[model samples]
Target: MTRIKNLADLHKIKEEVQSKNRLRSSLDYPEHLVQIKVGMATCGIASGAKETMKYLNDELEQQAIDAVVTKTGCLGYCYAEPTIEVTLPGKEPVVFGYVDKAKVVEIIDVYIKRGEQVEGIIPLNFQTIDD
Candidate 1:
């Protein structure tokens, strides 16, 4: 926890809290907002998931994009650590693998903003045990 040493610190805390609140409220209508889930398991962290998650959050804020970014356990893609699942409004979620900083920028600009697909997309696995 960070100590509130001054008015500026307090204001910063307030802004952070407000931002979190807004993000929570946005979940009420998630279908209208962009949703992102970052894998943060051991494999993911080892592959720099922390940095990827931070970049996504910061970039979204800088672009003033309304998004709900959350962290999750292993997405079952250990080979593709640091993976992210992005869901656009009214669209199916797409999971991308091996996401570095440059890939993040490309995803934001091309996929998220322009609705265009980018490389490195991991095709969703659909086979069931019952099969």
Candidate 2:
């Protein structure tokens, strides 16, 4: 964490946090929330899952998007490390690969906010044994 060097810096951080709080509280409807699952396996972490997770947490709250973000285990896409699955309200889940800060923004802005598709989508090629 960055240290607050002076009163000015402290106040700046306070304002930033307060603004985020206002945005976070705006999304009260649970039924319409977007669900996000981040893969945190060895490959995922090595490919920058931690940074991606942090970015999602902070940025999603800051944007006031109604999202339920959670950490998940290996998504069985070891080659496509740092993956995230996003399920929009009343829609099928879409797994995105090579997730980073930029991809997260695109997912939120294009996929979640605009209800449109974004790049980096990993298509479903195989089915589970249960199926």
Candidate 3:
């Protein structure tokens, strides 16, 4: 940690700390504005999921978008590694596969921001049965 010598330095440190805290808080809060789950299984990591996840995190902060980004294990879609699932408030979660940094931005701007669905969605296959 850097020592704060002046008011400006203190303020900058405060802001940085607050930003990090907010990110962690968002992850803990289930009722977050947006929840992004990046698949991080062995295959997903090999397919650049790590970079895609970082891109989403940095871009969301840069765009001042309040979102919670987390990592999950494989969704049984190894063929389409680097998959991401986005869950917006009051909407169904959509899973997109083969995500790169560019695609991640497009998902944020077009899908999350503008409410438009992008390509590369993995169709939901599981049937819900009443138990």
Candidate 4:
């Protein structure tokens, strides 16, 4: 890890992180945009959640898509560690498994952009208390 040498550098780092973590700050996300949650628990990390998250972040920023990208804890599918849950405005959430960089592209082009479904979905097995 690189050490901060001065206050200016520290502030710069802070700004960078805050910019990337906009989802945490925006609780009431815009209703017309998409929202994504990446599973980042221990299992998820071990199975490439970090890479998936990075890819999604870069893609969303590049495409200028109006969406909120957030990191979440485990979705209880340890076998599908690199998992992601996507929610389009006014629709039920869909959980997808084995989300690699390629899958992320499809998710954006087909799921988020075109508002169509794609493969790799992990069907909901158990209903949450909110259900």
Give the clashing residue pairs of candidate 4, or none: none
Q: Write the per-residue lDDT of candidate 1 for residues 1-131, one digit (tens) a residue.
A: 97889999999989998775555445455435788999999999999999999999999999999888999999799998889999876677899999989999999999999999899999977776888
Query: In lDDT terms, how accurate is model 4?
Result: 0.86
Error of 1 at 46 (Å): 0.6
Assess the local accuracy of residue 27 in candidate 3 as a C-alpha lDDT between 0 and 100: 42
Counting clashing residue pairs in each candidate, in order, gives 0, 0, 0, 0
TM-score, cand. 3: 0.73
lDDT of 3 by residue, 1-131 (tens): 77778999989988997766455445454545787899999999999999999989999999999788899998888888899999876677899998998898899989999989799999977766862
The true-structure Cα RMSD of candidate 2 reads 11.7
**How accurate locally, in lDDT, is each candidate?**
0.88, 0.85, 0.86, 0.86
Of the pair 2 and 3, which is ahead by TM-score?
2
TM-score of each: 0.73, 0.74, 0.73, 0.74
Clashing residue pairs, backbone N/CA/C < 3 A, model 2:
none
Residue 20 deviation, candidate 1, in Å? Answer: 16
Off by over 4 Å in 4: 1-31
Give Cα distance to truth, residue 10, candidate 1, Å. 37
lDDT of 1: 0.88
Whose lDDT is greatest here? 1
Error of 3 at 108 (Å): 0.8
